[model samples]
Target: MRILAITDLHGNYSKIIPLLQKSGEIDLVLIAGDLTNFGPDEKAEKLIDMFESPVLAIPGNCDPKSLLDVLERRDINLHNSSRTIGDVTFIGLGGSNPTPFNTPFELEEDEIESNLETLINEAEKTDNVSVLLTHAPPHCTLDEVPAGNVGCRSIAKFMDRMDLIVCGHIHEARGVMEFGKSIVVNPGMGSDGYGALIDINVDETPKIDVQLIKA
Candidate 1:
């Protein structure tokens, strides 16, 4: 199926506008996190209004609980939930490990790990190929920063072989990587108006093709 995966949008609508226009014949739009500058309902609503396909979003470090609450009102599905479309099972986790900034949507290492374990188990029960969508990168994989310190070792340990791992939070490492039979992609900065389009086949070898879309 064709999917448009993005993250760290931080309220940039110009980029999103083009992305929505270019996304044709897409079955789903997966948003990793940072949809809003903080946690504004209107921003999330505006994004939801632009899409024709089903959108799955998770809250990022900057996302406010109020935003999540408002999303519930809009009947939008939030993370900590699982959804299946076509031959793929899309699992989402919001927020990231605690950072120096004390962001609003921070999660502890253990918290993320435990939650990830549960998600993994749940995905295993499904008959479809698994795809993990998260706001933080998994350890030394695609989660590196310009400072050279890789983030979330626990995440890497919990990351088993999956069809694809789409993440954000590390803006510099905005690209794709093939690791341990899984295609890991970080769409860079939603704030910068850049993201990725991924096409995947869930059967057999689970082929994945990613296209970088920039404004």
Candidate 2:
């Protein structure tokens, strides 16, 4: 399956069209978070309407929790949920783990853990490969800040079981890393025209390929 992963758009709808145009033909689009910058639900709905392919998305720290309603109305909200597409099962956890700025969708560590556990349990029941889509990166992986690593420790501990993790919160920490059996990717900020392309081949032995793209 070919997938396009984008995150932290922060209400730059103009970039969405160009980004999709550059992405070419893709089977699915996974939006990590931050679709709006404290904007209204219309902003999120408008962005979802622009996509031709099926989109699975979650709300980011800068986005209001109400954005989920828009995503739900469009049938694309992946927050704290799981969806199976082809041979892949995607589990999503939106929002950050408490930031100094007090973003609109920040969640506590315990809440994150509970949500993730439920999703993980559901993922375990599926025969497809498990992919984690989270707004916050795993601790000490792609979530490092100059001050320190401000990622979800629970996510890191649960990394070994997942096939891939697509996350983006810390812009400067954008890149790819391998932890245990899972591959972690941070697509950076979409408003800045940064994203990642992922290809998963389920024939014979499953193969995963990823590339960072800038528009």
Candidate 3:
């Protein structure tokens, strides 16, 4: 399967066109978060409509809480929910742990952990590969800033449990890393034309290929 993942859009919908064009024959598109810059729900749908392929997305700290209902109406919101498509099961959670800035969608670490736990239960299946789609990066993995590695510790603990994790929020921490049996990828600021293309084959030895790219 080939997946195109974009994050931190923050309402820069124009950047997505080039990324989509470059990512040919994509089986799915995953939008990590920040579809708006504290903008309205209309902005989110506009971006979602731009994608021709199936999309599974979550809201970001910058996104208004109302966007959740919009995403759900579109049947694309993955927040605290799980969905299986093809041979992959996607479990997702939106929002970030409390930031000093107090963003609109920020949540406590415990709430984030509880949401993830429930999502995992619904996503876990013996026959399908499980992928976690989160707006916030797990602690100290792809989450770093001038302040420190202030990521969700609860998410960090689940690192070894998933087959793959696609996250963002720390724009500078954009890259890929291997954590035990899981592959973690942060596609960076999609609003700035940064994205990632991941290819996976269950039969392959490594099973995952991650590439960071620009629009």
Candidate 4:
């Protein structure tokens, strides 16, 4: 199945719509986080409605619980929950650890760690190939910014066993990582039309391909 993963949109519908339009027959679309700017809005809802394929999204730091409520009312599925499409099992988390901005959707490191623990347990029970979707990159793989801080260390440890880890938040490391047997990637920011279009075939060795697409 072909999967198109995008994240850290931060309310830029122009970039996102074009990317989606440019994609050639994607089977599933994964939205990591920051679907909107400050809170829930019509743009996010409209974007969700426009997608032809099944979409799974996670709430970003800028998104409030009200966004979840809005999505639920509209029947859009948000992740922190897992869903299986074809042979892929998608797991997602939104938001980030506490930041100076004091965002409404902040989650502390420990809180995220606890959530990661639960996700790990659920992932362990699944036989399908696992793919992690998050707004923040794990402690220090490729989510580093100019400030030298990478991301959640607990997330890194938690992701150690997954087949692929796809994230945003760090715009620089918009590439892939083959850590031992695991594949880790940060799709970068959506404003520049930087993201990943991943294709996975689950038979035999489970062939997986990733491409960094620019807007």
Candidate 5:
């Protein structure tokens, strides 16, 4: 499967669409978050509707909670939910653990932990490769900012349980990490034309490859 992952798109669709245009045949487009700039939801929807490939997304800290309705109506909201396509099962968690600035979609740390516990348990039922789709990168792994790591601790602990982790929220820290049979990638800030293309070959021996891109 060819998965195009992008994040923190603070409403500059023009910056990233060209990257997609050149990306051969993409099976899926996963937007980590920040599809809008504190949103009108209309603009986000317009961008999303332009995609021909199937999509799944979670809301970012910058996204208004109201954006949930727009996503729900289109059957693309994946927050704290799981969906299966082909041989992959994607589990999504939106929002970030509280930020000092009090962003619109910050969730408390404990609540974030609890939600992941539920999401993990549910996803474990499947034998399909598991992908955790979250807005915040797991703590300290592509999540560091000038102050320190601002990712959810619970996410870090649970990450190894997934086959892959696709996340964003820390634009400056766009990067990738591999540990314990899992790979985690932050597709950077879409408004800046940064994203990643992931290819998964589910043959007798499954393997995955990633390419970070700048449009």
Candidate 6:
């Protein structure tokens, strides 16, 4: 399966059109969060309408909780939810853990942990490859800032069971990492013309290929 992963749009919907146009063929679009810059739900709707392929998305710290309603109206909200595409199971968790900035969609660590645990359990029940989609990266992994790590420790611990994790919150920390058999990726900010293309081969020997692209 081929997937186009983007994050931290922050209201730069215009960038997406050209990006998708040049991305060749994509089976799915995975959006991490921050569709709007602390903006209205309308902005999120406008962005979602631009996509032709199936989209699975979640709200970011800058986006209002009402954005969830818009995504639901479009049948694309992946927050605290799971979806099966081909042989892959995608689980989504939006918003960031509490931040010093106290963004509009911040959540407590325990709340984040609880939500993820429930979703992970559900995904494990299926026989599909599991992918975790979140706005925040796992603690001390790809979520490090200049000061220190501000990621969810619970998330890091859970990584052992996942096949892949797509996240973006720390823009500068954009990159890929490996934990056990899982691949963790931060595709950076789509508003900044950065994204990731992931190819998963689920054959006799399963493998994952990822590439950072500029759009």
Clashes of each: 0, 0, 0, 2, 0, 0
TM-score of each: 0.92, 0.96, 0.97, 0.91, 0.96, 0.96
lDDT of 4 by residue, 3-63 (tens): 8888777777678777887787888888877888785566688668768888888877787
- Model 6 agreement with the true structure over 1-215: per-residue lDDT tens digits: 88899999999876797789768899889999999999888988888888888999999888899899998999998999999988899999999988899799988888888999999999999878899999989998888788899997768878988999999989898899998988999998899888999998788465788898887
**What pairs collide in candidate 2?**
none
Locate the minimum summed-lDDT window of 10 residues in model 3.
118-127
RMSD of 6: 1.1
Which stretches in model 2 have alpha-carbon errors above 4 Å? 204-206
Candidate 2, residue 77: lDDT: 84
Candidate 2 structure quality by residue, lDDT tens digits, 1-215: 88999999988867777777878999999999999889886888778888889999999898999988888888888898888888999999898899999889999898898889989988988778889999999999988788999998888878988989999989898899998889999988899989999999877453788899888
* Predictions in order: lDDT: 0.79, 0.89, 0.89, 0.76, 0.88, 0.89
The deviation in Å at residue 102 for candidate 2 is 1.1
lDDT of 5 at 157: 87
What local lDDT does model 5 show for residue 120? 87
Error of 2 at 215 (Å): 0.7
**Prediction 5 global C-alpha lDDT:** 0.88
Give the per-residue lDDT of model 1 (tens digit) for 111-198: 8878878877888887777888888888888766667755676678756657788989887888888777677889889767777888
- Tens-place lDDT per residue, model 5, 134-212, is 9988888898888988888889889779999999998888888997878999988888888899988778454778899
Ordering by lDDT: 6, 2, 3, 5, 1, 4
Candidate 5: worst 10 consecutive residues by lDDT?
Answer: 200-209
Root mean square deviation (Cα) for candidate 2: 1.2
